[model samples]
Target: MKVSVLVITYNHSRFIAQAIESVLMQKVNFEYEIVVGEDCSTDDTRKILIDYQQKYADKIRLLLPEKNLGMHRNFVNTLQACCGEYVAILEGDDYWIAEDKLQKQVDFLDKNLEFTICFHNVIIFHEDNQYQPYLFLHNQPPVSYIEDLLIRNFISTPSVMYRAGLVDNIPNWFYEQGMGDWIFHILNAQYGKIGYIDKVMSAYRIHAEGVWSSKNRDWQLNKTIKMLDTVKSNLDGQYEEIIDRAIQFYSQHLLKLNSIHQGTTSKFTTNLPKHLELKDINFIVFPDWNQEEEHLYQNLYCLVRLLLTHPENNRIALFIDTTKISEEDANLCISSILSNLISEEQLEKNKNINVFLVGKLDQIQWRTLTSFLKARIVLDSENSDALLTSGTEIIPAYTVNQLIEFGLIFIGSAKPYKLNIGCGNVRFDGWINIDIEQNYKTVDLVCDARQKLPFDDNSCELIYNEHFLEHLTLKEGLFFLKECYRILKPEGILRIAMPSLEYVVQKYMSDDWRNQEWLKYPEYQFIKTRAEMLNISMRWWGHQWLYDTEELYRRLTESGYINIQEFAWGKSNTPELRNRETRVDSILICESQVLK
Candidate 1:
């Protein structure tokens, strides 16, 4: 195999030798030469390149630009000057991970002439080697995506080795101010399927100037717009996916960064676009806004903030200017998204908990009827200001050094109240005995409730829960309600089960159980169903929303029942239920006063 290596440098005087040496030490059975482009570096970079040229004149082609030609131009000119059957790229600060990196790639492409570009994963590291980005330990994918690249960019530039004459000429846009070799990869992948060698090929140095290491706080993003624009400006529609992926790559990167810096609350804002893709949310309600001038994004931001603050896994009805997208088109988009979001295997309508999302104010009548009927309780998931007023409170009467037990912990188990929540030891006894993985506990029957009879309304009269719902997704929550309604008989009841919104707002606003370690357990799949069922009203999140004793009573009456009663535990300690002679926050149920 005959190959040419291109090493582009800006101000990499100190690290250039190490990069060059890696190429020199390659054990390839081929004729190869090194081409170094010292882009006008206002440092000792050029001098070092010429000095290396004098020593290894036969093996090296040093191009010293009279003045800095910038990275894009320098790379293009450097490649044009090199004459080799196959060309491999390397940057200044990075070095080969294995001397065989090139030979393996070259041999594969040489034999399979059908191949144009082949790349591999790089072990990224800091200058000090203190923190390595690529965890050979974690072991992620070796080589990946090029398609829908407007969606992602996994192949690094320095990791590529393409057959000569892959393109007629270097695209002019690469020399543009903000463009780089990624653009070239996009162009290359547009023509051929990307090939991979599942081994570390290079040590990608990640310093401040590293493409992905630096931090950018803006997480809500769309990359397709920029790519489409770029494609329109330079390459024509042929590179549409490339541009689109660039946008998605940036947006996804921002999402990850926000998760790192902003916490779970920010996810709602970041994932709104993703949620809008949900197929279940029909008739999206935008309470107020002119979507005509990017105001929709602003409105969404506000609503997402509200949803994050409360436990009610509810949606805010932000108003969008109907002129932007017709109701039919908008509904189609949201419904399709919801459909894609929830799989048939995991979703069961009219079972467990189901949330009905309405879009326009015209739908408020239906909402009111549904709310009056299904809303055993409805507090804005975001309205934490008046949270946990469930008329339950308790004191730390005594101290103990033991871990809390599930059965004995609930305070409402006394005379005035009884609740039927939590996996009954009687029914799930088999589950309790099962190990975390040996049984595949939850993913099978234990995890799902299909054959589990779901719930029986009067089974237990109240619910006592805490930090659990965020595990199962929104679809799972809907199923929980279906079970809730099915289980309840005429006057049967449910006590609130879960962490208080006030508690979450003040101390756990950004808390979510999805990312917890428990999710790795076999029971987590089943337990997560419980987590999704728990929600906060004001924040419109995991717990859904907080409930009041009276609202609970009202919902029963509205749902074709009679003789209802409720109590409020406003602004009081939770353990000691306000009216209950115990130390807990809970609600009681009686015959519904009104019958629907």
Candidate 2:
């Protein structure tokens, strides 16, 4: 074959037909075949390519892999399968505007022996119409060298045609990079000078699905720096100066982006087109007309203070005009302000404090913000000035229960409540279920119990947990027991169930129990030896420390609990705590009472 056109596609069902038709319309004198590598698209791209292949069997060929090989591997495998002396590149999302695009590049390379690769300028078409279409490059020279290409990638993939064997010895480092086209151009340009044809032959489409165009500015710059580092390392330092200059350029830009996102510099306000408004917020240290750095800081401080002081059930909506500032920067600024203005104890006390960051307001966003303000208004309509004021007396006990039922107030119930700590999927009625992971719908409070529990002193009536203590280390378990003791009222009950060390050792020592039903459990079935069984029991399922009866009793006693007692499975003297154990076999159960 005189020339081969390489097209690699995945999930490009909408544009693959136009790409294929453009290749078939090429007016060339010599033989050319369309070699498409369809990497297991989850869309109709494969079916469409199949229909085209059946219609044009002699001119088009398809390499359909059974599974999805990612872009890098698919490009490498498809490039190797090309049989032509010269190869032209095109992506499934792009197409040729000029019918004689292939003929022009082929003629340029066929006549010029010194030029190993030939390319031309193409139209940069924005598929989303977010930007106007324009030419890819301007003021193009007739010839360029490797040093000129190393500074940046000026070649558009769909506009290039190169000698097939020039890139035969592909570098090992090429496979490690996330992108392929730029490095491929560099590799092919190493053999000879790059020839340029000043013509717009194809339209390079930019859309949400386009691989490189879809990434954010930060990701693109970071990837460019990483690729340049790889090139500098593998090329034996021949272009070290140019590559170092490019790395420095990208690194400086990356630092600026990070500073902006972190809100570390005061110059960010100058970049804003208009003064950002912190709407309906009080405690302004400076006048609203001033847009100084101190004004921004004071507003942020008051915002954090407002969020911290409000009642947990009250939804206080604070809207900021984020036309110039990104939502990410807004969130970071709030976090920075909170860390600077509030004490850690204040944050710990307000564990349920929530501050939501939103972008520039649209119709839906405006409605959501208004709804939050309306809810807060309905809750505090009688005494609007009482909001965000600390040290207010709690409501009378008679009305507290009624207010809690409506989800309007949470002042630590008048009656002592129960706790189901580390309650993963197995929840008890009338108890507040707490777990670190919120994957289960049963979890009512999703804070780490290792930290201070979000309950007041001498507040809880009963605390129960099962199959959870073993997941914590001996130190964490002891601290958690103390936290429970601190929160439980006098004569309050604390119950725990966990894997027993004695049971695991006894089962491992006994040879006859290897085929027991518990051993047939899915996680234990893979154990072929008794030692493996022991390891799986102690080390699996994130188990850090397993306790025997004596160790658990000693830890509870150390944590200031009296009346420590052992109980059988599903057995508890307290009615609410009874029958809460989920695992029946090879477990230890214990209960204790706190006496002040």
Candidate 3:
């Protein structure tokens, strides 16, 4: 055969027909065949290819796989199946516009003995947006080397035709990388120079499903850098300077992109809101003038109390200047603030509270830094009392000290509450159900129970968690127990129900392991042997630490609990905490109390 047009498609039912027709319309004098590797697509793309194969039986050869081989495997297998001396690529989502696209590329490679690959410019069409179509490349050189290609992949896949058998042994690393066309071009270009036809012959479509075009900017850049690093290592520094330059260029851009995404204003400045209205009270906590770490914690604690007390539509914004500290320190500070003051559950449910990190406070126009928050007042340390600004709309600003004083006066009036931490879909009628994820409908408050509980000391009447303690590590579990102890009032009960390690061991020793109903869940369906079941139980469901009655008693005692007791499944002495357990198999239940 003179040429073989290679087309690999998956889930491109809408555009497969056009791609097939483009190859058929090519006016060539030599014998050519269209080779299509149709991976198992969930859509009708395979059906379309089968119909085309039947109609053009002699001209088209379809290699349909029973299962999806993914893009890289399909491309490699299809490329190896080409019997012609030259191969032309046309992806299912793209098509050639010119009838003589293949003929011109074939003629050029045939005459130019030194050139192994040839390509032309293509019109890029954005299918999902209103962007006008443009050429993929401009002012193209007639001939290019591997060094020029190393800078970037400027060649469009649909417009490429290369001499077959140039890349006989594909590299194993090529399959691991996200890019295919660029690596293939690099492999082929190593044998000879790349010839550019300079004519716009094909149309490259960019849609939501297009693999390379669908990825975000950061992913694309990072993937490119990874690909280049692999090339650099595989080639053994054959083109180190060129590849290093390319890697550096992509790495710098990636850093800047990440900085911008993290709300860093080092490279660019963001405009502050001129005015905002709040339905309830708005508290804007300014940075400590002295930048004292202790003072920052005090302010955050005050804000957390304010949020818990008012549970109405109250808003609080805390500003942190990150320019004074390194990025790592800034991140540590933010994590400390969140893990100590507000849980992720609180941040998700109460969207009113915000923490803003500014790269430089001097760059902002407003005296206070507020972004994407609706607030009507500013709370600063300098302002002792509410100060009304002389403007079109007078906004009130209060000091943190005054807020603390106000909190001290009203904090005692708040009612005591019961908590159900890590409550996954098992909610109590009169208790506040809390979990890390907000997707659970029964979760009343979305916050991490592993973090500090958002409540006043000795204000909780009861605390309960079932099958949730094992999910935390030993250290984390201990810390969480102490948090529970701190929040519960004197003589307040704390109950915990979780999987019993002793029960699992007993089941493993006995012959009734296969009869356990809990192993039948879909997650444990892979357990075919007794050893697998025993191993999976300890590691599955994000389980970090398992406990028995003895270990449970020790843990509670370490967390400063008194009068620890063991109970049966769904059995608690306290009336409010009774019948709360849902799982009964291999379960261990324990209860303790906090005494001052």
Candidate 4:
């Protein structure tokens, strides 16, 4: 056999058949075999495996252990049974989607003999929750070395395909490893370079019974400690520093756990030092500063110093002379200074600490400040009591609002402009992901897509919205589409992926519709007749409007879009677009361009 697909199972009865069927459906010119280790399953997984083995006798080799060998032993024993040049791994709960998945990987490895391993992306689906399924290896680099594996395990189990015969004998440490896949990738990387394909061709299911699923923070830390220990042993002090840092990183989690367990206890709440006074920075300068504002700015110096006792205060007062600097120029200066102080990496690391913009505020400038610095606009007088309680700082700046806006412009221009509207935890790498909900880490901007986009006209080069348009009413969707057109550049690309009404209707009316396993989805479980099912499919999942191909095309055209083209699932004329996972039969993907 040219390739051997290894599947290790224990009690994955419900999902085992799907995994086997996925392997059987591989479209490849070269011969391949499926090696399954049942490991004496208590569920019907063994029966399902036996049925598959009996049916595809010539292509399948079964390993039925007399007793449970656990995951590691079963994996090693099953891997030993593989007789192919290349070995692919897929746990019993995960399944491949693309028929050409094996073909693609084998072709890459066959051409590039220097590469010992290849991997693609896989969608991670939560079996019991409403969490949206997302790609696992979406942001990983295309190539990795042994040192890369030492840093972190970018490889997932189902997405991996490595050269066989690399491991003559499984080490005793392999059985003791916390995550088998991590060690497996490290072993393969020792031989040759690792390759990556960007396509999402497989899926990993996360359920309660899975070993790593539903793990607490402490349990996850323990697993990390184990993996780091195993890795440190293999590497000859090459990554000792990072490993030490990682150990320390996990060690710090103990303090975080304690803090969470106990109530909100400020480290600086008791007898704290007063905030520094701003001698030269006395008055707040804005477009309009009345007598009320004058009174506020006169006492700003002392008031800010008194509020610096609390530990939660991250407020900084700016003392910029707006009389000498224009609003636009002030924005740039403030942005440059803030960019120097807080890097993107730093912002990501310190998420809980709010940077308060405590200075002069222009109507337009304050909005820009909030957008770029992600700072809260605060007045020393308005928040006198709260600032004293939270330990606010009064730093000096010349112009507040204008400086903030300038910084936003500078940062926004520096980054490649791609927008993901209504991005619900499915983040696209190098894109400004926006959603209605805010998780700070994943979402860059939190705004309703139905409203005007929080971007300048003709600013974005590419915009993507998956299954988001259907959640808006017909009028709302049209307005949203128009907004998309407005934000996209003259030659910008817009891709909309949503449920296809026509496909749902056709599938509902088909004779084999009831026989379809997908119809057993919770949304359609109670519905009996074809019409009822179709109606529910259209209305459920917070859907406000559904569209067919023709309707979608019409909407795009009405929104001043041109060069509208239809695309199949996982197929797009635009490069870097087709690699995204698709919903297949139930979804429609259409692309439109602003051709001026």
Best by lDDT: 3
What residue pairs are clashing in model 2?
Answer: none
**How many residue pairs clash in each candidate at the backbone level?**
114, 0, 2, 15
lDDT of each: 0.47, 0.71, 0.73, 0.67
| RMSD (Å) per prediction | 21.3, 21.3, 20.3, 14.4
Residues 1-596 of candidate 2 have per-residue lDDT tens digits of 99999999999999999999989998989999999999999999999999999999998889988888889889988999999999999999998878898889888888998998999988785675433356779898999999888877889999999999977767778888867999999888889999999988888888899889889766887798889889888888899867765664454345344433555333323332242322222111111212454656664565456445555424333333334455676667777776764574355544544455434443323322232221221110112222212101111111223323322223223447688888877776557777775422365555688889877788788999887788788889999999999999999999998879998899889986485556653323346898887876776557788999989999999999999999898888888877888775537999999999
Q: Score candidate 3 by lDDT.
A: 0.73
> Model 3, 375-444: lDDT tens per residue?
2224334222211111101222334443343232122233457788888767775566777754223654
Q: Among these predicted structures, which one has the highest TM-score? A: 4
Minimum summed lDDT over a 10-residue window in model 3 is located at 385-394
lDDT of 4 at 261: 43
lDDT of 1: 0.47
Model 4 spans with C-alpha error above 4 angstroms: 216-218, 242-596
TM-score of each: 0.46, 0.45, 0.46, 0.52
- Candidate 3 residues lying further than 4 Å off, grouped into runs, are 263-596
lDDT of 4 by residue, 1-596 (tens): 89999999988999999999989999999999999989998889999888889999999999998999989999999999999999999999989888999999999999999999999988777786335455686568888897777656778889899999997877788888768888888877889999999987888888888887667655665677677777777677877756654443343333233233454223212221122122211223222222254464443332233222222233333332243335575455445444543462244334322222234333223222222223223443243333222221121222333322332222312222678788886776557778876543456566778788767787778888888888899999999999988878888989988878887878787976676545644323456788876766666557888899999999899999999988777788778677564454337888899976
236: Cα error in model 2, Å: 1.5
